[model samples]
Target chain A: MHKNIESQLLKLIPPQSKVLDLGSGNGEFLEKLSKKNISCHGIEIDTKKIIISLAKGVSVTQKDIDKGLKEFCGLGFDFVVMANSIQCLRRPLEALNNIFEIANECAVTIPNFGYWKIRLKLLNGKMPVSSSLPAKWYETKNIHLCTIKDFEDLCADNNITIKKRVYLDADLNPLKSWFTLNSNFFASEAIYHLEKK
Target chain B: MKIQQNSFEYKESFHLLNGGSIPGFELVYETYGELNPNKNNAVLVCHAFSGSHRAAGVDKETDKPGWWNEFIGPNKAIDTNKYFVVSPNNLGSCYGSTGPATLNPATKKPFGKDFPLLDVYDWVASQNLLRKSLDIQSWEMVLGGSLGGMQALEWSISFPENIKKAGIIAATSLISSQNIALNQVARDIIRKDINFEDGDYLIANKKPRDGLRVARMLGHITYLSESNFKNRFGRKLQDINNKIDSSINFEVENYLRYQGEKFSEYFDANSYILLTKIMDSFNPAGRYNDNLVDALRHCKAKLLILSFDDDWLFPTEYSKELHFAAIMAGINSSFIELSGNNGHDSFLYANEEYVSAISNFLNHA
Candidate 1:
């Protein structure tokens, strides 16, 4: 599933573009990007993850996204990515707004909380847990999970134009008619490319 | 292949009198290669905290190469063939220069903790004396990294008429709170140790080995990026014959331990304390002067500040801040963030791109 998402991301970004990966866990994506000559930078709050990222030679700043992106002004980067980390943010929208202001393009990937499995589990009075989100509610960093449709609507409300959208099933296979039916059932994750209006 | 040692006495040993006097010391310096009649081919190379007047080529005592042999040589960046190079052992340093470790004739003992807090400006004042002693009016370039970069910045600002170009690498305008706090913690560790004996351990034949080791360990963490640590050490375990206690402890622990242990052999604990404190008090911003731009406005040199992408100790943002200040000051300054996985030590590592960028910059300068 991670491999599929990575391949799709690689297709979207140009080779050698400067990229900043927010909440860049272990810098896996930046390492992949660097092989393609992309100048990669990252920010992660976790000290352990930061150590791992630095070991890979990825230029990462240890910072909290809640503080806004002020360090990167005038030093331009082509893309800012928040992968599987949007839900973990205290103020996800505000962070996204700052990302858009600093980057020429922004990409984000989030788990669809309204998937049928989660819905059925909630209906049975049980908190949802799946391969995509394996943590218990107390242990989870996914505080602000949202559905694909809800995310698109939020983007629209924020005046952030969707440049591209890709949907994946539970196994990360491309989902057909993902923009419509997948918000509630078939799709497990949604990847969106956004540009500031 | 013989290197000569040069010496001179300061007009008055501020190391003796009012300990806080600036522009108080006279500098005695040695030069390699010939100085041009106009003296425009001169290159000033500032030393690190513990480094000495010998920067390039070989040292006579240990039959070892100079500290920065990789960067300065016949065909190197600051080519001795084309440029007359001058390296001064900074004031408050131990290398044949006037420092806290030096003997005070009046006190008949080492200055110990009584050494005045030396800043980048103090180092520049000594360099000015050295320049006058050599009969050289100005320098074509002033270059350094780490503590040396601080001196280079001072040369640009304090003696703007002397330097034509300045190259500052892997340095910060102001030491961050984290660094200051870290140094304070290390100092506390040393001070609390019974062996330290209030910095009078010399009489007792005791040294703060444990305290200095802990300080170096803390400092070593900041010197390398997390990325470098993981790549070099990761979760690798130390080799052991006994299987009962076998555990895959991270390799970084052993590496840092080696660094700390080895550092003690070559460095003095009290000097380490003093140097770190100097680094902490290094605020180019000046007292009651919050305006960095105004502070840097006096610089006339074409400045270049380089930061490694992975160097968390003195992160790229610090370099960016300096670059911004230089711009507002109308100084011709360029900031380049080089790609490297080695963190802060990348400047010292065998990085081809890093070397190329610097080589190009110096050639153009």
Candidate 2:
């Protein structure tokens, strides 16, 4: 799943482009991106992750993503990547706007809370737990969990253009099923390549 | 671990950053482990204001562990077995180094007030001389907390290529005005002592005991948080038995006075005055017209900054400032705000999380 996330991001980020990572945990992915000649700087607040990120010699600012990216406004980064972190924020709407303000091109990966399997679990009177949302209801870090449709509605409401959208299954594998048209109910998660309209 | 102090005397005249010069000086330092053949594994630990060369190991004479014994040992945070550790006493400090208490060759009297006032840059320069004397090409890491942290930051900036990494803990790039004011009160308390004699108490054959004692007591308040103080000695009285006589003393007062008395017994009055003044004026950004990014632009060394959330003396925001400058200057840096009640003194403690943070950052290849 981690490798799949990397490959998906690698496909969008070209060589020699500057990247800003919203929640660059441990700087592992940024370090990988740096190997491809991509300049990467990150903003992370977790103490353990920041320590590891620094030990790896990656440039990361210790900051809360919920605070937004006002300081980075107009920095003209080629890409601002938010991976599996949008659901954990208190102000997802403001964060989306903040991401669009920093760069014209950005990538956001989120767990689809509205997947069909999740609906079935809820219908069966149980809290949904998939690989994408592995934590128990009480243990979950997500405060703004949203479905793919909800996210798309948010983007549409804020004039964010969806350049390309890739749907992934429970194991984060990109699903190429015939019914991808109804992805809001089938996919467990998503990789979104968005642009500022 | 058993350790011995070593002395290095630079015969040439040592110049101060303040356009003053001393006719040669000596620096006493302690070393642990062995310097590698490549000469790149030396970790230099700069001492805080009242700190000494004894950063780790047991002093054979005193049978006491060094200040950072909890962090630097065979398999500790610095890992002495893998890296050579060197801790040096600054020039103006009174820990077996050339200081105000040391005899001057000019008139065969203690330098005292005549001792050229030194700054953080001077300490860094003197440390560099020691580094050259040891024949180390560049340091593996230079680290410290408080005043020591200032020295580490200075080393990274002044001798940028000479240091590979710097760990600055509980320090600020610039001393805030409130801090200067507090330090001023401490310095004035010492200076106004009847025996101070214009910082020449040594020549007068008198020690400013009362002045130094009161000053340290006042200075100690800023080093801890209110919650930590409460934890240690809140409203508890030291003497519950003296109720009839009403000679009651609070546990906090007793603790402060005890610490102050112990400090005054050893620390030189002039040295205290000079060192606190150095802490007063440490603004690297001042040279760059108050632009922190431009001040940090020339730094090639990677930085690890650790700040305590409860440290009001140098708050977490100050550490964040350095992180911001490091990022904007295109340097690799990381900042960690550890949660603890020890306040400014939190960096000196061996908190498990703090230890791991230091260990992982320093030992990373």
Candidate 3:
């Protein structure tokens, strides 16, 4: 399953291209790319995690994404990733726009809030709580949870074209059916591959 | 355990260069690791402001461990078993080296406030003299943090052909405005103290302890993060029974006061004044008129810049700026923003990830 996801992520990324991982926790993905001889770097907020990434011998910077991406200007990476961290951003759309200018291709992952379990909770006049969002509403760092459809609309509004979509099962397996219907009821997460139009 | 101390005189004083009358001096320092016949295993450990040649092991006078005890030794990051590390006390510091605190030959009195405002370049020049005196031409790696990192950067640039690798942690290409302002406040506190006596307190045989303590307290605040402070002290009271006393109230307040009191014990007020002033003036990027990117382009060592996430004093943003500058300058650079809550002081503490990151970088670089 890991190998399959790796392959899919690899297929989307250009070979040996410079990659920047935003909110890169311990640089797990960057380490994978480094093994493939890719020039990978990252920006993380947690100091301890940055140390872990450094110990792994990955190049990363500890930075707050809310500030801006001024540090990355002119040194364009081919790919920029916002893996599992977009929702935690203070300004998700603004950060996405900054990422768009910093990299040629962007890969973003957001929990599918439209999933049946979440929809049912909302229908019952209750805030949604699922395994993906384990924290209490007040305690959660996820300030902007966007559904797959909502994200698609956002991309369209921002003039970003979707290159591919990968819907994951509860265990992060890629679903074989239409993500809108199948993922809404079954899948746990979704990743969107996007590029500027 | 062979130890030798030597000093050299320079005809043209750096003080003269900075419009002072004191003469330039040099300090040669060394250490023992496993020595190969070729001496290729030697590592140069540079000292930060107020630090001495005593980078590792025990100091005879204090009977205490070295300043970088946490990260140096047999199996530490800059392991003494694998690498021979030599850290020299910078020329203008009040350690074993000659500085404002050193006695002048002509006047038979300490340079005191008469010492010149020394720059980072001057410190590197003194190291060069030490290197020549020791007959050591090149170092495998130059390692340091803070002012030490600034010296490492200067070493890498000034003697690009002499160093193989450089590690700069919790430091900046230029001292930030905020840090300068903080130092200025500390200086002002000391200057305002009646005991300061306009830096001419040598005859009085008394030091400005109260002012120095306050200065140390203010400076200490910047070294720690809010999260760290909250976790360690929060709103916790110092003593349960003394709630109504309204003195030495919170644990955090007591901690800061204790830190200030202890710091003033061994450190001199004048030395603190000079060092803090030097730190304020430190700008490895050089004068404002010059482009910083062009100045950084001179670095030849494979670079590793480390910053802590909670280090608001020199935040991760600053390290990112350095990484970008180094990349723009076409230097083989690596940057890491470590997850730490200890703020700027994180580099001196034990965070497993930080150790690993540095070890891995050193092993690979």
Candidate 4:
């Protein structure tokens, strides 16, 4: 995830709207939402994270995303945020299906595998391993990693509408005009705001 | 601080929702800490199936600490120093309260099987009497785990204005058929015991020890997780030197036998049946045409639901259902699943994080 993850998400959600944060890590993002008067709930997997969230007076449920969000169906949340979480799931497709069933809109961030730097690394005939993409192929938690084009294809095929998409460089800085022109080939990561079509 | 056992007698006949009435009933209870002048700093503790009014402090005669001593004491999770704690034995319990084991005024004999069945509503009504007797306007928090948790939720639903906050731990608002089926096996075993005599064993100066023992053993199975059992007593045997073909039993068997033996010795079979029946009959949503959102619509208390990851009997899913209803019904609510290996009985165990989580909710929420 980007260093400005909360700041980036904080901009998308309006005050007092009900939001469900998927994979709320350590509850810092939820705390930020609470300050803005947003009625926010979180689904976190780690016990320590849940405890921290509880202490903050934020209602967070401990659940495994890989198990799917069937219980959260019909919750009617305004927005759902999945910052650097979808790729780690065993079945990202099923996760998406359940998420759309619950929330009207979603904010998702993913590391772009089609970045020009990653393409250059592939030319060396080695699986890329850098500060940006640190894990080796064998031990990477990103089992369902995908490029921006692939994700867009998934959304288009599933009747989902991408309202907004932002591309960032390796340093998490938003790409400017020329870089945005070829985002799939140059951007290091991408954030998208999606709605069910 | 030291605690003492007390009794509150309602002289008038206490009527049950089922049209059965008791001429007069007594509730044995205990109080810890001094009630403030305003009486707003009061906390009520509801006990589970076999829990007692002795939820805190040690008994002077036996020198044994109460059941929930880990969570309720001078400076425990439920700090008696800061809040007045009231724990009462429900009416239909064998624990000093008026139940089947008590002599009936009409026949001058134990009520036995004739003792009318009681439910969560009956207990809440009787407890409301006790609350009035104490002159407390509203409880700061009413909380419990398992059957006790069900009673706590009943408080919020039935007396919406009297309880400021309710913490439901390791319990469900409605008992599933799966849970009822589990209780049925135990019920059948107890009813068929030769010495049970149709719950009239007290008149015969005999106890349904075998039947009650088997029931408790079966109950012990659901109160724990398979992982907990495995971790506690895996392949260990009572007599390790004995060959596998011999009559040696595993440590788990020995533990269950010990638990059953103790439970049957002190707990009454008739009370056991009555309490389980109460548990099965607890569905507040039934009155609202099975809509939990409508059932909780009038509740004013902030609700906190806590579940354990390993509590298969009432898992985190059950708590999530409650959370869904609470939110939809427009109530301030929270649901937390504590990570633990202790299963349904995790609330009774003294873990730092678990205790802090609850105390934080009680103090802040």
Candidate 5:
């Protein structure tokens, strides 16, 4: 699930960039970035996740995402990335604002709740269940789930410029050709590289 | 394994930060592993407020290991096998060192309240003198937590050319007002005792046991958080048949009482007051025009700062400030807040992650 997203993130990050990752689970991504000579740190809430991250020699601060990155001052990092965890935040917009304040650039991935399968499920009078979001409604951690369009709108409203965007299917394969194109509602997931406008 | 305690007497008399002077003094310390020929592998580990110079190994009298035995063995985090380790009890501590409890040579009486006031700066200077006496020119690193951590920081600043790295765990550049207030109340408890006799209780051969117990009781409370206290004791009664109106009803009360009693047996009341006052006045930036970032700019050692999530006394926010200041000073630094529910004392516990981080940082040196 992370291999392709990591490649996309690698493309966006410059060499030797200092990075702060939000919700960096297990720290495998940061470890990979460190191999590329990038200084990496993380913020995670779960104790087990933090232990796993620390075991990999990644410095992670244990703090709730809802509390925001009040510890870090403005422009502390070269890049800030929150992969596959933005939807779980109680305040995604505020988190994004904090991310921008701490770093010059950021990347965020969102599971497209507006995918065609979800639309089909809604038409059939049922909630969607896809590989990217498999949990039942009540048990899901995606408290603030949003579509690609909704995320783009949030970025525009918050004066964040979208530098790059990519659409992927359920298996994380890029939607490069014709089977269905030109609409975010048809993709399973979306990744956006953002910067302050 | 057995560890031998050693002492060094500074017969020349020393000066203190508060302009007080001592005619002569002694420092008790311990060493582990062999000092390499080049003398570059020496690492000094400072102790917290209540800690001693015995960083590792078992004591003959108590049949117990040192406070940081897990972190400083042959193959442990600090790795004595690879680095020479030196730990010294601070000047104002009651542990085997010259302090208020020690007799004054001139008057032939205990110094007690007459013991000169010392701060982090004096402690750093004294440690530096110990370093020189041992024929060591510079250290590979200086590591500590809590009050000890403050001294390590001051070491880097006070002796900028002597240390290469510093591992500061659960520490802050300055003590918060809330923490100072807590220390104040502990002092009040100690002073209000009728037996205190203006810090000269030893003359009458009477000890202020009750007052010292109350002070230690509250001081222990500040070391932990409500979350940790509740999670550990959780309204559990000490005795099932005991009434709630009793002096000690809950398990936590029993725990605190036991700890306080044990503390009063080993620690001197005057030493506690002096140490807490030093802690209360700790500010590494005091000499740098009160600008923390500017003060940090003078530090030549690389820094590794760690904090625990549940540490309310020196919370993660304080570590963040230290990190920010280090970054601003353009020093190499890393800050990590560990996940633990044990509050400020989490630094005392040995965890795989915490150990690895320290090992990794020291290895990089």
Candidate 6:
């Protein structure tokens, strides 16, 4: 899953572009990105992750995503990426707007909370639990889980242009032949490439 | 690498921030790695409140490793092999530095209450003199934790062009009212002691050992988080030789008592009061229109600020304030909070993440 995201993110970024990653975790993705000649900086709140990221030669700052990106100057980064982290943010839309102010392009990956399997589990009178989201309801870090269609609507409301959309299955394998109209229910995860309108 | 305790004295009288001046003062320091001919590879490490110049390697007297021995070595985070590391004992300290315990050159008596009150700014001013005397034109980095962190921050602001980078760990830009209250309570305990003869306890041949012990006991509690206390000691009772007395019940109480007593044996009561005052008075935004962001504007070096999640004393909010200020000032800055159960003292512990953060900032950033 990590490798798949890396490859996909690599395709989106231009060589030598300055990138900022929100919720960059231990900076594994940024470290990998640096190998492709990209300069990556990250904002992570976890001390352990920040340390690991720093040790790997990634420039990561300790800052909460909820506070927005006021520390970064406008258009300082060519690209900004938030991987598997938007749902956990207290203000997902606000954070995205802040990132858009600092980067020309952005990418965000989120697990689809409205997948068919999840809908089936809900119909069976059980809270859906899957490998992508292993935590119990109370212990889960994600607070704003959304489906592909729900996210697209949010983008439209915020006047953000969805340049590219990719759907993937449970194992992170891209579903090339997936139906666009029912992607929200069929896809397990979705990655959206975004630009400000 | 081998570490040696070295000393330097300023023959010219140095003026104090509060009032008065030190006629002649000495600063004790330790060095790891050799100074390069160009002197650009030097790094100054300011010590915390009670810490001394012996930051790494074994001390000859105690035969124990330096307080920061784990973090500074050949292959450690702040590798001595690549940079020259200098750790200094602050002036108003009991540890091998000119302090209340030092004898007055004029009267042949311990300076005692006569020692001038020195703040973090004073320490930085004095340190700058030492830097110049050593023929160092600039420093590669100036790093410290807690009160030491305040000194490092002061150095960056006072001598911006002279420092290339700075690491401030578990520190604050301004001491809060609550923090001052806590220190006041500690100072009051020391002053209320019957043996504390107006800071002339040494002349009276009496020491405020009990008062100092109580102060340290309270400080130790503040240094540890609730979770760490519960995990380490909890409500577990100590083995008291089959006695049911109320003297020492919980293992935690015994631990605090032991630490307090051990500390009083080596640490001076007057020095404790003085150092805590300096810590309380630290305000990095003082000269820059009383605005933290404005003060940070003058800082030319790259900055790194670190805080611990469980460090309720300095806390993560303080680090954020400093980080935001650094950014607003347009200084190259980074901030991160390391997860720890040890609370404020987490900076002293051996955490891989903490090590890597410092190493990466120094080597890469």
lDDT of 3 at A112: 86
In the predicted model 4, the residue pairs found to clash are none
TM-score per model (chain B): 0.88, 0.96, 0.90, 0.96, 0.96, 0.96
Give Cα distance to truth, residue A15, candidate 6, Å: 16
Query: Residues B1-365, candidate 1, lDDT per residue (tens digit)?
Result: 22345765557434322245632453545566667888777888887665677776776687877767777767776667777888777777666676665666567677666667776776787787778777888888888877788878878888999888787888888978987898898888777778888876654667777777777888778777888888887888776642222342555666676677777666666677778777887776683286787878888887767778898878888887887677657565655677778777666654555555455556552
Worst 10 residues of 6 chain B by lDDT: B237-246
Docking class of 1: incorrect
DockQ of each: 0.02, 0.56, 0.30, 0.34, 0.17, 0.33
Model 6 CA lDDT for position B345 = 89
List, residue by residue over B263-328, the lDDT tens digit for candidate 3: 777676778878877777766666435566676677777778887878888776676677788777
Residues A1-197, model 3: lDDT tens digits = 14545566777888767888898787678788888888878888876777666656677766789989866867757798787889999999999989977876888888889777788889999887787888889999999998888888999998999999888877677876765465666667888889995
lDDT of 1 at B130: 78
DockQ leaderboard ranking: 2, 4, 6, 3, 5, 1
Candidate 6 per-residue C-alpha lDDT over A1-197 given as tens digits, one digit per residue, 9 for 90 to 100:
37887788778877777888888898889878877767677888777777666556656777778986776755347899999999999999999988887887899999998898988988999877898888888899988998887999999998999998888876787865745567787788888899995
Q: What are the clashing pairs of model 1?
A: A54-B227, A54-B228, A55-B226, A55-B227, A55-B228
- lDDT for every model? 0.74, 0.87, 0.76, 0.85, 0.84, 0.85
Tens digits of per-residue lDDT, candidate 4, B265-355, equal 9999998888888888888787789888899997888887889889998888787888888877767677778877888888788787788
In order, the candidates keep a fraction of the true contacts of: 0.00, 0.52, 0.55, 0.41, 0.16, 0.55
Per-model TM-score, in order, reads: 0.62, 0.95, 0.72, 0.83, 0.79, 0.79
Evaluate model 6: give its lDDT. 0.85
Residue pairs of candidate 6 with colliding backbone atoms: A47-B338, A62-B335, A62-B336
Which is the better candidate, 2 or 6, if ranked by DockQ?
Answer: 2
Tally clashing residue pairs in candidate 1. Answer: 5
Task: Please provide, for model 2 over B146-195, each residue's C-alpha lDDT reduced to its tens digit, 9 standing for 90 to 100.
Answer: 99988888888789989989999999899889999999999999999999
* Top TM-score model: 2
